[model samples]
Target chain A: MKTLVYVAHDNVHLGDATLATVTAASKLGEVHLLVAGAGCGAVAEAASRIAGIGKVHVADDAACEHQLAENIAPLIAGLMTDHDAVLFPATTTGKNIAPRVAALLDVMQISDILSVEGERTFTRPIYAGNAIATVESSDAKLVITVRGTAFDKAEAEGGAAEIAAVASTDDAGKSSFVSAELAKSERPELTSAKIIVSGGRALKDSATFENIVMPLADKLGAGVGASRAAVDAGYVPNDYQVGQTGKIVAPEVYIAIGISGAIQHLAGMKDSKTIIAINKDEDAPIFQVADIGLVADLYQAVPELTAAL
Target chain B: MKALVPVKRVIDYNVKPRVKADGSGVDLANVKMSMNPFDEIAVEEAVRLKEAGQIDEIVVVSIGPAKAQETLRAALAMGADSALLIETEEAIEPLAVAKMLKAVSGEVEPGLIILGKQAIDDDSNQTGQMLAGLMNLPQGTFASKVELEGDHVRVTREVDGGLETVRLSTPAIITTDLRLNEPRYASLPNIMKAKKKPLEIKTPADYGVDIAPRLKTLNVSEPPVRQAGVKVADVDELIARLKAMGVA
Candidate 1:
């Protein structure tokens, strides 16, 4: 099978999701990388060096800038005719573009696939990770989005694949990028963070969430995450959300602070090497998966724990 | 302008889904079902628009088994003007759902269609975008905020890194994210009022669309269990354990 993997990029560097997507796409067939953005030649060059990629296709145009799904979806669908399967990293961009392409191809999309069972089969989490469903698609052309945490990231520089430029497709002109407000942080990316400290709705307000959670994260040099409850309560940005609907992460050590672990939150972080819970409520479902469970008020314990560290 | 909102009936978010012993699928038998949480947000957003006088009417639609009428009624109680049920028992795929909705939209010609980003049951997150593609309409997905202008809708979307704003033409698709709005609970009085509202029932065959499953489920199983470790009495003990494990 011939496969095309969409590389998530920001016009300069490829996101970590791209390498993991390559790792997943490699399981299906020979993988080719597609990089679409404005002035993204370096991104395409970086993608070509990924270990498993056979070729890199670049569609560098102003219309491809910001990866507005309206323009990018049609471009990807047009390229689908040459590949038997198309795989994307189940990131925000992937989730946005894959479905549009799938609809264009009139095929069903298999999303957040955890494992590849066969050429046409995959296992995905449903009911927010409570159960796993193995799905086999009969579509001639498969459109899939893979959970990056489920696969090892492909090495950055092992192979030298040829890069080719593809003509830019027509813009849909129905939607355009207005602006973006990205969270600027020195901490590691959540999905790739070795250690993550996550807070929940108990944080109360954004100021408290930052003050209480940032100290612990600083001590461990960990990325900060939040349950959807915390995010919905305006305690943190949506990007900080860690859950079934949010970013899926599997860090080395995951510490849940003041979080009543909803199944959705656990779906993202349950694969952590070692889980720790610091919720005041001992009965919180988070403790079920936690290696070390501490039943103490986060308001007092977090400060004490940070000082002790 | 009319708004079309798609609501799905799924196992309630509060209830833990259990896999059947035979590994065929999740056991929905006797489980409490509710309109998908995200769909509730969609319904709430549409109702808010109507209350604000921006939308003339709110049309809620669901495609599911007979019991899905309850989900539609919930939407009606939440302020949707009417309901439509595309009756089917098959585990319909996203493309087929999109096609069916596309057919329905042809008759309704709604100014906007709002849907949840995904259903908790399948977590496909495809139908709204698929419908937009099939109908050749612009989509604002994972929208945290939506504002309708004269001819277009400005949507603030939840992206990977942070928030992104996009402007799409009218007759667009908007998929609700968690932060969109807090869905209001249906009061007993509104529930009674919803019972008297019109709910038209149709089948997939009525729309000349086949709601078939494109993917076959081979098995359903539980995820690997994480064993409970030693409970630490205090911060000192927790640090000691972490140090002993070389994970600190």
Candidate 2:
């Protein structure tokens, strides 16, 4: 199978999710990458170095600067002539664009596959990861979004592949870029972090959450995360939320502070290698999945833990 | 300008689904169903837009079995002017659903369309973007906040990183995220009034769309359960355990 993986990037640096996606694509067969953005030659160059990629196709044009679905879908669909399957990283951008391509190609999309069972068969979580469904596609062409944490990241530096330029398609003139407010943080991104320290509504407000969570996260070189209750209570930004509706992370260690593990929250982080929970309530659901449970008030324990670390 | 909101009746968010012993799919024989949480937000946003004078009419639609009319009536009670139900018993994929909605859009000619990002049942976040692709319309997906300008709409999107604002011309598509708005409950009087609202029932055949499943579910099963581990007496023991596991 010839699979085309959409390279997630910011026109300069390739996204970490793309490397994992390439690994997922490599499992099927030959993997080719599509780098669609304005002046993204560096991204194409980075994609070519990923271990098993066969080719890097660059669509350098102004229309794709924002990676808008209106401009990127047609470009990917047109490139589907030679590829049997098109894979995306299942990031926000991938989720936004892949559906348009699937619709344009008139195929059903298998989203956030956990494993590739057969050439056309895969398993995906439904009902917020409560049930797993194995599905097979009979379509002539396949469109899929891969969950990044389910696969290991491909080696960043290794083989050299040929980079070729593809003709850019015209803009659909439907949507236009206005502005973006991305959080600027020095901490490792939550999805790729080695360790994550997440807080819940028990922190009370934003100031207390930042004071309590950030100190421990900073000391441990961990990414800061929050439960949906924290985000809904205005204790943290939405991007900091780690749950079924938020970012899914399976890091080396995940420490839940005062989070009464809702099923949705557990869905995102239960796959972590080491799970630790620190909550006052001994009967919190978080203890069910926690590898190490510490029944304590977070106010006293978190500060002590940070000092010890 | 008229607004269209598409809602889906799915296993309620509060209900835990159980896989069938026969491996057919999640058991829904006697499961409680409600409007998909995000679609309820979509309906709420449309009602707010109508109340704000930015929208002249609100038309809600659902593509499901006959019972979906209850979901449509719920939307009607929430301030939608009318409703449409594309009745079908067979399971329809997102691509087919988008195609049917495309035909509905042709007849409705809505200036704005709002839909849930994904249904909790299938969890396939595709229909809105697919419908936008099929109709060649602008799309602002995962919108947290939406405001109308003179001829364009400004939408604040909830992305993986943070918030992004985009401006799109009229006759566009917007999919609601979790933070869009808190949905309103249908009051007693409004529920009674909704019984008299217009609701038209159609089929995929009526719109020349094929409601076929392209993907086949080979089996359905439960995910592996995570085992609970040891409890630590204090932070020191937790640190020691983490260190022993080489994760601290």
Candidate 3:
């Protein structure tokens, strides 16, 4: 079966970079891609290296940037003929675009997928990632947004495939971008990061937030995060916020500082492999799930830890 | 000015979802269901904006089945002015839901539209943005703080990277993040009033919408189980154990 995975590039010719482990999913049939028109050549060359991938389709177009629903949704719907199924990295962009595309194709969408068990059955999160639910797509064509971290990266092999130019669909009337404000980040993207360090409102002040958390994160080569409480308290920016309503993170080492773990808050980071809590309140809820609980004031402990590192 | 707060009926977030023996879906036969926790936050914010005298009236609207009326009533009990239920027997796709909201928005003439960032059941999180797109209005998505000033609503929105403050003109849409507020419970008097308050039920047919579902479900299954690890007695031991797993 021919499968297409969308990659983040100017267009879709780029290869699938899977750094994580693969289970039965790694064995899916010939993998192909539909990337942006701008870098279609480069993307196609890269896709050739993915061990299981056979063909590459470049839907290269300037309009493809940002992967807006109007243009990409119809484009994906048209491409359904060439493949048995389609896959997307379960990022925010994928979440918005995938289902809309599925709708346009009149097909079912299995999203935020953690695993693929069969030709039609998929496992996904339920109740905000607290539990997993297995879903089956009865439709002939399956479209899914797979959680990128959960899958093993397709190994690269040097064999290029010809890039097929799928006809473009004009979405001039769909929607126009008034403006977008993408938060500037100096660290690795949150979902893809290996380590994450988060804080909460107990830090008391916004100015003190960066001072108390950033340095420690810098030392550990970790992404910085804040509990929804801290963001709502206006102590940090939303991009730094991690929780049920924010982002679900599963880093190798997750350090929670001054956070009182609400179920919503825990929903985001509880999936992390190693959990460490640093809070003055020994009774803080975060300590309950923490692999390491430090009973010390964040104001004092943060600076000390930064200096020690 | 009229303000519209969209409510979502989802599995009570506090309760864990269990799969049925048949693998059909979550075993919700008797599981607790409530207004999506985030919708409660949206309702609370709109109510506060109304109570603080910044907004005139609040309407809670749900785009679901007859059962969704329960969610709308819950919003009314929390101090909304009225309730609207877009009764669609079939599951309403986000795009279609956005389209219906735009049509209703034209009639209600709301200065602000407040809804949860994502519904817990599907977690699509697209309706708000799609609605804004169809209406050609600005949006404050994942807002943590919002204020009404002059002709603009200065909102602090949660972006993937950080917070952004946008000054959207009066008729803009805002989706509430979970931490937007710790929702207030319905008071006794308001609950009593909500029972008597008028609830306008308009089917999608009434709105002249077809309400066709765009996406279909193939199958729903459970995620892989992570083994619960043993608890450690001390920090040193914990670190040592984590290091052994190469997870520290």
- Among these predictions, the greatest lDDT belongs to 2
lDDT of 2 by residue, A1-309 (tens): 999999999899899999888888888899999999999999998989999789999999999999999999999999999999999999999999999999999999999999999999999999999999999999999999999999999999997999999988998787899999999999999999999999998999999998899999998899999999999999999999998899989999999999999999999998999899999999999999998899999999999988887
Candidates ranked, most accurate by DockQ first:
2, 1, 3
Error of 3 at A122 (Å): 0.7
Which is better, 1 or 2, measured by lDDT?
Answer: 2
lDDT ranking from best to worst?
2, 1, 3
* Candidate 1 local lDDT, B85-161, one digit each (tens): 99998888889999999998998889999999999998999999999889889999999999999889999999989
Residues B72-149 of candidate 3 have per-residue lDDT tens digits of: 889999999889898876767676787788889988899999988788877766677667656656666677788888
Superposed model 2: Cα runs more than 4 Å off? none
DockQ for the candidate 1 complex?
A: 0.80
Candidate achieving higher lDDT, 2 or 3: 2
Candidate 1, after superposition: displacement of residue A130 in Å?
A: 0.7
lDDT of 2 by residue, B85-163 (tens): 9999888899999999998989999999999999999999999999988988889999999999988999999999999
Candidate 1 docking classification: medium
